[model samples]
Target: MTYCLGLLLNDGLVMASDSRTNAGVDHISTFSKMRVWEKPGERIIVLLSSGNLAITQAVASQLDDQIRLPGGEKRKKGSTLLTVPGMHAAAKLVGEAVRKVYDNDAGSLQQHGADFIASFILGGQVKGGPMRLFLIYAAGNFIEAGPLTPFFQIGETKYGKPILDRVIAPDTPLPEAVKCALVSMDSTMRSNLSVGLPIDVLVAKTDAHRVFHRRSIGEDDPYMMGLRKQWGDGVRRLFSQLIDPRLDE
Candidate 1:
């Protein structure tokens, strides 16, 4: 299990993912769940994945190879998503990768009760266009992030999603979006034992065409420490300030 989030912002996109994977309580390991493919100035795509580690890795590998899309009959070399012409095309390609892996492994994995499960959050921008974000399923289909829903989250999403819905907006400033992402992550880490620490984050700004900043936020990161405490205090304060409903009743 893991936690990954993609925030659609006025500036561009912000993506973050935790790196903990556990087969059992006694068997645990660290693996990167955040992936980036870039063409420098042409396009930049970030993918955050969760669920069945093997399945996600297989899907990513097939995408890097740019597998023949049933009829597209074209492929890429190291041809990860960054070369895709636009966000829509990139999304379709990712969905295809999911379908390919599901076809090859779903049945066998299901027999073993592994469920052949995986999901992805893909976001970035293409050169002549605006920024976009998508959530791709194991079924080879996806939906773009929209004005009403400005973000997509996968994996251990419940705890973090509340903060995002409460604080984020389509016009949020870039720095504020980063802070929101961290706060959201902290909430997930606190609530879910499976979603551990040491997070990977990528921040992209519009038309910059590449990642703006990427960081590994450790459990001991000072700024995150400060922000976490502040959020806790704010929540307590809000609770305290609420008028007692019992009096009205």
Candidate 2:
């Protein structure tokens, strides 16, 4: 299991993902679930993945391979992320990649009693276009994040959703949005052992066509530790301030 989130704000986009991948109690491992591609002034793309690791990795690999193919072939097939005309086209490309992976491996995995499961959050900007965010599902379908719904999460999402629901908005500043993402991830980590740390975060400022900030937050990072403590203390303090029903009666 894993937890990944993406927020699309007026200033830009923020994305985060935990590194933990767990098959069982004894079979846990850490693998980055974030993939980024950038062409500096031309474009920047970030993808957060969750679900069956094999399927997700295969989908990513397919996109990578297509992007690296010779220029003529890439253009001829129109399958490369780099050549997509806009964010919407890029999202459809990702969905098609997911379908390709499913077609190739779903039957074999099902034979082993494994369900074909994978989902992705794709967020980025293209030169001469607006920044966009998308949530791509296992069925080769996707939805774009808009004004009312400006974010998306995949895998182990429930534990982290409340914070996002309460805090995120299309006009939220980039830094505040990042903080909200961290708080949401922290909530998930506290409640679910399957979503462990060393988290990857990416922020891109709208129309910049490049990543504005990126970092890997570890278990012992001072700032993160401080934030965790403050959040916990604040929550406790808030709980304590609530009126007691019996006393009021």
Candidate 3:
């Protein structure tokens, strides 16, 4: 299991994901759940994935093949991540790609007693449009993040989503959103052993349409360490300040 979150704000977008996948108590491994595509000042795209390792890897590989070709097609309409028109179109392309992989592998996977589980949070901006985000399902349908719902997440979301629900607003600043993302990840790592440290974060700003900042927070990163301590202390303080049953005594 893994935890990934994507925040879309008026200022830009922030995304984070942990790097852990476990098959059983003894079969634990590390794999990245984040992917980024950028044209540097032209456009930027980031995808957070969770679910079946094989399916997710297959989808990513197909998308990577289209753009990084050394000598392949003569078609002018060969749309890769770099050339996708906008976030919405890019999202549709991702959906189609997902469907293609599912069609090719779902039956075989089931026969092997495997589940066809995978989902993605796609966020970015195209050169001519405002930033946008979508959560694509395994069935190939997707929903964009609305103004009221300015962020999207997938995989092990319940343990860490409350802080985002409470703190994130559509107009939040980029750095603040990133901070919230790390805090959310911290919450998940604390409550669930499946989700671990060494999280990848990407922050993209509007108009610049590029990955403005990227960081990997390990078990002892200063900012994350402080956040966990402060948040825990605040929670304890809140508990202490609350009236107990003995208040009536």
Specify the highest-lDDT model's number. Answer: 2
- How many collisions between residues are there in candidate 2? 0
Choose the strongest candidate by TM-score: 2
Candidate 2, residue 86: Cα displacement in angstroms equals 0.9
Which should have the higher TM-score, number 2 or number 3? 2
Can you give the lDDT of residue 214 in candidate 3? 92
> Against the unseen true structure, what C-alpha lDDT does each candidate score?
0.87, 0.92, 0.88
Worst 10 contiguous positions by lDDT, candidate 2: 69-78
- Model 1, span 1-249: residue lDDT tens: 899999888888999999999999788888989988887877788999999999999988887655445533344432447456688888888888889888899999979988877899999998988899999988889888888999988988899988898889999998899899999989998898888878898999999889889999887899989999999999999999999777663
How many pairs collide in each candidate, listed in order?
0, 0, 0
- Total clashes, candidate 1? 0
RMSD of model 3, in Å? 1.6
Clashing residue pairs for model 1: none
- Arrange candidates by lDDT, highest first: which order? 2, 3, 1
Better of 1 and 2 by lDDT: 2
